[model samples]
Target: MSKQRTTQPITTGTSVIGLVYDGGVMIAADTLLSYGSMAKSFNTPRLYNIEDRILLGASGEYSDLQEIVAKVKALALQETTNSMESIYVDRKLPAKSLWNYLRAVMYQKRSKMNPYWNDVVVAGWDDQADKPFLGTVDKLGTTLQENLVATGFGGYLAMPLLREKWRSDLSEGEARALLEDAMKVLFYRDCRASARIQLAKCTSDGCIVSEPYELDHSNGWNAPSMIRAAGDLDGDGGW
Candidate 1:
């Protein structure tokens, strides 16, 4: 017999992807919120920018994501207040430090058997090291520090494509193009995904999250007639 469930996620988001390139890190996610299998909302932004230095992309229960972000923002604000009292402390938190904090929070929740139900990618540039940073933390507080990371179906569908083409020396344009291609594949296959996506980057200057933009998949691959013809052929077994 199946065990009874007390609660389940209602609104959800799919697939958040991130990678480090030559000078910094980039992350992207589709603007879609799903209720069960239905696409409940569009134009939802999953990427969050913190203090113009860090980029956060999350995929999972929407409410859970909001809760985590709100808590983090509060923590950052508190840290900022404390920074004014200390001449040595930086005004903002470091990316790795923030990531670690999230890991701790997620773990605490997991220990209580009430996890956040989200997988989050954190990206930023290190001023001291003069380099880019990329990492991820999940609902169970599992932390992964990697040049590339993703959540949800993106792990299965987009990761292979990212791994095959990613290079440490990739320029910003190249990295964006690669991410767009991977997102296109996801939009084609992941029913819960959307063609509208937002891209964010962390560089020496700062982090910037773009407005939601439509993904271009106009390669005749998803033409309505083509899909209809393929379905008809499959139904008739002409081959």
Candidate 2:
């Protein structure tokens, strides 16, 4: 006789951004996992290197993301004949393939009326044409786009900035600078976004991750500064 184990659902927090460049793609996300509206933890890496070429950015419920990650890991293991070496070398498990698989998983979950409530951005080089590709997949298994994408609170604030500066022919440096600026904007505007950010670039060569960097808000106006600058520090302009 065996005892059945019961599992409690896990929830996580995140925000993500992705943009395409001339050579490949760039994606970024903050590392703050929240419990409700409050920041509960930090340094949670939402970006993942699923295969040699693909990168994934997950946002929303942490438990759902973990389950998806686990599913991908298991599928990779099974498809590789249980050989680690084979899995690494095989090109069959490319990013696009993984994207389709994920979409299916999400769609099935939605059909069952128990969706994961998470969104993901998949960025990588198109294996067949050797071109850059960026796309998003939500809980409903919908996948679309490459120019620019965002998830969570940053989506509302960051997407506008992205559209303003985005260009399909941007150089790598230009694209990176644009993204960094956008992140800065998000940090200042979006309540969920923190001053710290983690960024990654995916090219034909591979993925390059930056050390987490913090945003400085010293130049921005605070309540005291606003009051002082308004010539009403004591609430009496006559002074």
TM-score list, all predictions: 0.90, 0.82
Global Cα lDDT for candidate 1: 0.89
Stretches off by above 4 angstroms in model 2 are 1-10, 82-90, 222-239
> Tens digit of lDDT per residue, candidate 1, span 149-209?
9899999999999999999999999999999999988998899999999999999999999
On lDDT, the candidate that comes out on top is 1
User: Which pairs in model 2 have colliding backbones?
Assistant: 12-62
- Deviation from native of the Cα of residue 152 in model 2, angstroms: 1.7
Writing each residue's lDDT as its tens digit, candidate 2 over 151-236 gives 87767888988999898899988987888878777776777667677888888887767777776666654645345535555765
Please report, in order, the local distance difference test score of every candidate based on alpha carbons.
Answer: 0.89, 0.78
